[model samples]
Target: MNSILRITVCAYLLSGCTFANSEAMPYKSWRLGFSAPNYMEVWIESADVVDIKEQVYPRAMSGTAAIQTPLNNTGDPRGWPEKPGIGKGKNVTGADLPKKIYVRWQSLVEPQTYQMVINVPESTRAIMRKEEKAFCAFDGKWITDYRNALVINLAPGGMAKIWVMGSCLPAIEVTKVKAVVDPRGPYEGKSGGKYDKLSDQSKAYVEKFGVPYDSWK
Candidate 1:
């Protein structure tokens, strides 16, 4: 009788007219774990962007969740039944590992010649090229442990999106995807002026591509 009463009370408490989805709340930023000295960081802007960000974790979930069990019948000690994880251990959260940074390589003027060194699978290079790419500190670093990558150049004022991929479930393996923009062709340096002000021509490009005029300029 006591057990029945406890279950009934629990059910009553849980039965509600509505429940809030914490994820649906407006999130300005999300924190993800990276190995010390090699952590990844990303800042989110809108709800639609958040939804896309959410997809990365699920892709890495299994890799993070699979913990190794002791052999020789010591009895399977899977923490997951008691405590589910976004990846390998009980501590893991639904955060994507080896974070990705996507930027809009909008053009400020009529598209000009540009160079990039994106770390993408050969398959994704064409899509990346169509988008404007930018220079990054770690672009084109040889990846000893990955397969399939490509690099390409794009037009001036064009845009390219780039990001990394990985899983940190077991503390075992992590991965990353790369798309980089390298400076190629001739680039002339101009002196400081009212550079903050966007040219009328560049402003239209920024509006059309949803990128910041100043950043692209």
Candidate 2:
């Protein structure tokens, strides 16, 4: 082949090789895992403006209750899970408790550290005229609002686990959990104002879990 034609062919081959290499490399991903007693649900709000909602059933019923977030674009949060709710009278109590209840979250994105905020209320069960309810514990301490959430660094393809433990009886079921993403480091300055500007729920979360590192502006 002539010099110019040979040069063109070599360039085309090199471009193809570059494309193949890019496709072969794995992208960054974030994942969350947890296990509970009764039915559980998780909501993921990603940095890419996507929302994911997953519901996990009991192992005894479905033979599998492991839940994972869908890696797809959800335009609006309200449009997802429009139904009323789950686990009304179907609660498992006493010896009939579920065997397995696990939830997970996974996503592919730019490699960077992220943080997770979990809400574990103190005695979600309330009795009008009954005795006070007991709280759940983790790592030898009660899982209160102050100790419910956690912050961790996640590298590419890394996974963060949050083990949930509690009773599976009626009025004591594990219903919902919210997981927010801090694309920036947990200690980075806040994009918006300080805690005052956050939503009521967020404000409550701050009160319980404390503000993230350097998050306040």
Off by over 4 Å in 2: 1-80, 84-104, 108-115, 127-217
TM-score of 1: 0.17
Specify the poorest-scoring 10-residue window by lDDT in model 2: 47-56
Tell me how far the alpha carbon of residue 75 in candidate 1 is from the true structure, in angstroms, after superposition.
Answer: 66
How well does each candidate superpose onto the true structure, as a TM-score? 0.17, 0.19
Which candidate tops TM-score? 2
* lDDT values, one for every candidate: 0.23, 0.24
**What is the lDDT for 115 in model 2?**
33
For model 2, name the residue pairs that clash.
Answer: none
For 41-139, candidate 1 gives per-residue lDDT tens digits of: 011110011122222222211111122222332322211122222221121134321112222121223322222222223233222223222333356
- Per-model tally of clashing residue pairs: 21, 0
